[model samples]
Target chain A: MNNSEYAITVKDLTKKFGDFTAVDRITFDVRKGEIFGFLGANGAGKTTAMRMLCGLSVPTSGNGRVAGFDIVRQAEMIKRRIGYMSQNFSLYQNLTAEENLRLFGTIYGLSDREIKTRSQRLFQDLDMESMRGKRVGDIPVGWKQKLAFVAATIHLPEIVFLDEPTGGVDPVTRRKFWELIYKATADGMTVFVTTHYLDEAEYCNRVSIMVDGRIEALDSPDNLKKRYDADTMDEVFRMVAKNAKRAE
Target chain B: MAILNALIKKESLHIIRDPRTLLITLLMPLVLLLLFGFAISTEVRNIRICAVVDRHTDETRAILERFRNNEYFDFQGLVASTEQNRMLEEGLTDAILILRTATGNMESQIIVDASNTTMAQAATGYIESMVSGQSGNSPIISSTLYNPQLKSSYNFVPGIMGMIFILICAIMTSVSIVREKETGTLNLLIVSPIRAATIILGKLIPYFILSAVILAIVLMLAYGVLGMPYSPASIVNVVLFSLLYILLSLSIGLLISALVRTQLAALIVSAVAFMLPVVMLSGMIFPIDNLPIVLQWVSAVIPARWYIAAMRKIMVQEIGIGFLVGELTILASTTAVLLTLAIVKFKSAVR
Candidate 1:
């Protein structure tokens, strides 16, 4: 595929800590307007790689381009063009939902009028108009998760990197959370998400299973299941992750 | 600039909503002012004393007699050498005067329980003065020049100011920053398109204003409540110097937040670990001269030491600006170094 056709193009990306390699020579491409799943067990180095891609951390070696900007030299430019929702889904608990959205909007350099207008639209779009002025802490975890997603995508970057956005929640809420991701992709925003849930991998247009700091398998869930001759994505994951000493 | 303003406003809301932060920011200075000013005085008084004398001499008798009459000593009467340790360990005596005479002139030692540093120092000091007065030779008359009344608050107000600043600016700032880190909000800020400097400055600006308000409150209490002398001549210098000190403390907080990974670690370091040096080595209560040689070296780096010294000169002595040159230079340079180090560490440590 042409480099410009991809929203994220990573070539031999690696990260090392003193004597141990955390993310070792991983290469992948994520197309625009697709929900891409990064699957790994605990300690599989998924978050480290995502952080490097998002410019929150520097890679030890290799090259990456996110939203058409070099990850290393153009980290600031890349940051401007991408949005991130960290593992915690960290909206300020003390702030009202509107305040949280406004804070993120303004940080993206949106004018006050723009922030107000867009946030109103976002709350409505998410069907979360009732949660606008309530403190985030006082809200349920499910609502907090949705608000955090809205905050991340408030500026409407070309790419949204979600680091395990739904780790702990009811199965019903998790399903609704995926709907938000679907809505974003429908708006032509690329979605890069990490989750340990094999069921969620099926929601992605394509998924990569990481083992021992490298991508052991990368394909659509149907293709991976077919290749592994497995009835479920869980079996496909276990088949590839069987060799991973790092998976805890 | 608009982003910074939003961040500051958001942070202000956080501070207002957080009871822990609000308590430390608002009520802490008042408690510390009273705690140091009246409750926990350093001016040692009415010490319990006993003596173990090996020789009976007119000189020794005179010294014991002086102790009996002195208002600072309780003069608990003579105890045998065998009872010396028992008296001290049992807490019956704050100090034991041990006098020995092999030659014509008697030599003496004041043995005190060294655990309570302030009490030990005071006990020994009173005994030394009593002993010197007994010796026929004329003793040097050294009276306090600045505070003739020798009120402990005169010394404590500056120290309270030092502590209040550290608690608010350093401890509170670090905790606030690390709270973001703990909640994972800091990573969001770090990943934002904005410069890291803007996020840090915005996070700290609210605490800076809180520190300023506390500074005003403390100064007013020191003058009105504690009856500290309000020297108009040096007031401007005091405020300016304190402002610089606040920045220095804020930088330390930034540096701490950068170094630590958790809010608990940041709180432990900034609140508990940092306060020990401020109280002990900063000459806040104990004179630096009385500190061990190693601690004196350690105190040289404590920003509060320089700040408290500058404050004492400015508030108590009403000293001229020329007198503060050394202190001002040290404080300003330390602030510069810490601010640079904090900014650099903040940028690198997050990675």
Candidate 2:
């Protein structure tokens, strides 16, 4: 595929913290409009890698581009063109769901009229209209996770990054959250999500399992399972993670 | 500009929704004013005195009459010398005056309760002037300028203004920023397209307006309740100086927030780091000149020291800007340095 056809491309991307390398010589390409899942055990450098791609942290040595902008030189441009959500629920709990939506929309340079219309439509589509004026902290955890996703995507960027967005939710809510990811893909928006739940890996179009700052395996889940002679993604994850050398 | 407006709006909502912040903003000034105005005073009034005369000469009667006419002394008539010590011990009289005729001259003796040394010294001085009619060889007339009654509250109003503004602005801004950091919202903000400088400014603007409102309340209480002299020029000067001081305090808070990770740590650091300097080195409760040379040098760098001095000149002395150029320059320069440091630290932290 041509360079323009890729949503993200990295060539030898590396990040170091003093004597330790968090992401070492990583290279991959995320196709446009694909739901790519990043799988890693605890402290396997998934977050450090995502932080570099989102332009929140500079890479120690390497070259990378996200949404066609250089991650290091054009961080501000990358920020304007992408959305990000963390596991901790980044919305202001003191603010209402609608207020969070409006604030993020305005930050992304949306007009007042656009914010009002888009917020109304987003809430209706999510069936979260009842939460329009309620404080985020007063809502259930499942509902807050959904609202945070809406807040992150309010500007409708070309790509969205979800860092463990379904952490600590019930299985039913986790399933519903994936439905939102699929909906974004249906709209032709690329999704780069990180998760520890191996079962969720099966839903992704492609998956990269990292162990000790290196991408140990990258392919479709079916291919990984067949190649490893495993019956399930969990067994495949155990096989990949057992080879990690980093104690942390 | 739109992003800034949105951020400011969000900050304002946080302030409004949090009852603790509203309480501090609204009630703290009034509580502090009443505390300093009424409870913390150094003025001495109505000292109790008993007179003992060995013989009732017309001269002695006339002298006793003089003491009775003065408002500062509350005269308790004719106690025997034996009862003088008893009255003082019972706290009935603060002092005793004894007059006797020896040879052709009238002799006088004053025994005062010296437990509170300042008040004792002042009472003795008053008795001596009344008896001798003059302590100096020539009659000397003295007049008090500005605050003629020498009200202790006058000395405290400027100090209270300096202390309250710094405490509220510094503590509130630091805690608010650290709260966002602890909640992980600061990370969200950093990832947004808004500039770092804009975010810092957005955080400060609400506190700026709130500090201004608190300043106005403090000034109103100073003039209305404490009876501090007020003029339009003095009001302008006080407002201007307080604004500069508030800006400096907000910058200090921002600096602390940038360095600390948790809201509790931010609160403790801001309180310990700022309160001591503001109260001790700022000349709020003690005179800067009276402090040790080392402390005096430290006071020169404290923003509240200059603010309290400038505020006294503007509000009480009613001086013009020309007289306060040195103080205003120091405060303005310090504010610039702190704000630049806070912004630089914040940028690096986010990166």
Candidate 3:
């Protein structure tokens, strides 16, 4: 993906809640069809900044465009063009998998027949087609995570935002979840993801680490590791975050 | 249109899937309606009364017979001797009716137990009308005490409005939002293309309709089944007050949900801090006028009180707009303010 293939553009995006700044001035761009990992810890402004990109929230003082729409003036359009999954594993536990899928599909303006066809295809693709009838609460956590991803991108959004999507899944399940993420990107959906998992960050085409509400480093996983003279993404994260805090 | 439909569908799922919210939303109105219909009533149809017939004359006997026939009184043990004091001191009955046996003067003296004025007044009116023709020129002097006329319905109508408003609006609203929060579906909605206004309206519309249904059911029971007077204007008053009260109640519910992360906390706060006051101080089951001065002032701040006041004015007194303008103004303004606050709080929660 070239510069012309940028799916999201951020210019000094800042978000403040009262006097405490949640996301300090941070800028980055996500290219089309690329798995962009947003790495940050708790209260590191990861969620806040993602919220801005998702168009669910506005930056306190910044200019940005998401999915080729102005963040401020075209938020509604940006919201329409993107999918989001929060760390809490967003799915209605009470409803059956089919009901949840149909709901999101319809909300995204899919017709009844389209929703029906898409839902059937989604269940088949996930290899848990029979689980569609079961209540989401009764399902295993791994399946729920994968279902969440499908629901988020059911409309085939140009850009999909995943906020720590694999927060508590087991290692094997997390690997399977990454496979689904890769498949989504292969279909030309831009994956703008946030996660605390350093290994997951390593799989990203490009990664940005946020600390104290600011992105301290942005580079390809290998380049970040090379720059910090570290063996792994985890060590690179520790070194950069430490230096970023010290600079502050 | 599509977004609104999605929200409605999601909201319905939340309401139906969560047992706690379903209980509060559907069962509350039914329970309160039954409780008020059976246990709480203003019309004293079978009030226990103790009457003293001073002289056992033919005319007086006939008059006493008239009293016995009256279904409103449950002629408790009668006293032929003039022991009015004993009748009341022993709590024998609500009031004592004295028929004078002054032979030459031919007059009737009716004394009522002043403690319960409503009973006294009703008994007084009955005796006066019964004996008026008994002795053509004789004078009938009746004195009433505590709550003369026993204006039970007058006290109940407004109280009903307030109680129903809290149950219908506030409890239902909070429970609905809390259910969404508990199920983790709120985030799903936030991710959807549904607009904020659409979300708020979607959650509120069903509860509003349900409130209307409750008002209709209770009103029908109050009038058709219970033999309470059916006032066309009062029915309109109930409907209008209910719509406004639902908005206020829903707003309170939304505010509670927004402030608290969990449904349990929202439920607790809404019940203790909101529902209790609207039920008690709104003067739905109790009279704010009789409450302490401080409580009376407090009642002024309770929108339910104003709603009840408007209901009472329209239904019981059959008063005109002049009687309700003040209460109506207060209720309307409070609703606007609460709704605005709720919107702001809801926005913050989403953020």
Per-model chain B TM-scores are 0.78, 0.88, 0.72
**TM-score of the candidate numbered 2?**
0.90
The residue-level lDDT of candidate 3 at A119 comes to: 85
By TM-score, is 1 or 3 better?
1
Docking class of 3: acceptable
DockQ of each: 0.71, 0.75, 0.48
As a whole number from 0 to 100, the lDDT of residue B40 in candidate 1 is 84
lDDT of 2 by residue, A1-248 (tens): 12498999998999999999999999999999999999998788999999999888999999999999999999999998888999887789999999999999999999999999999998999999898999998988988998999889989988899999988998999999999989988998899999978899999999999999999999999999999999999999999889788775
TM-score of each: 0.87, 0.90, 0.79
Tens-digit lDDT track of model 2 for B1-351 = 999999999999999999887996789889988888898776666888999988887778888898788898898889988998899999998999999875556789999999998789889988888887732443766688887987877888899888888788888999999999988888888888889998898999999999988988888899999988889888888888889999999999999999999999988898888888888888888899889999999888888889999988887789898899999999999999999999999888887
Q: Model 3 Cα displacement at B20 (Å)?
A: 5.6
Report the poorest 10 consecutive residues by lDDT, candidate 2 chain B: B133-142
Residue-wise C-alpha lDDT for candidate 1, range A1-248, written one tens digit per residue: 22478999999999999989999999999998989999999999998999899887889999999999889998889888889997778989999999999999999988889999999898888778898989999898998999899999999999999999998878899999999899889999999999978899999999999998999999999999999999999999989999889749
Question: Candidate 1, clashing residue pairs?
Answer: none
Every candidate's TM-score, chain A alone: 0.97, 0.97, 0.95
lDDT tens per residue, model 1, B1-351:
989999999999988898875886688789888988999876788889998888888878888888899898899999999999999888988999988876766888889888888888878877887787777575577787989988899899998888778877888889889888899998888899878789888977887888888888888888899998776777787889899999999998999999998888998998776788898899998899988899999999998999999999999988887988999999999999999999999988765
Worst 10 residues of 1 chain B by lDDT: B132-141
lDDT tens string, model 3, B23-127?
765566566655665567656566666667656778878877776888887777567665777777878766666666666444667666667666566667766
As a whole number from 0 to 100, the lDDT of residue A60 in candidate 3 is 91
Clashing pairs in 3: B114-B145, B114-B146, B117-B145, B117-B146, B117-B147, B117-B148, B118-B147, B118-B150, B159-B284, B170-B249
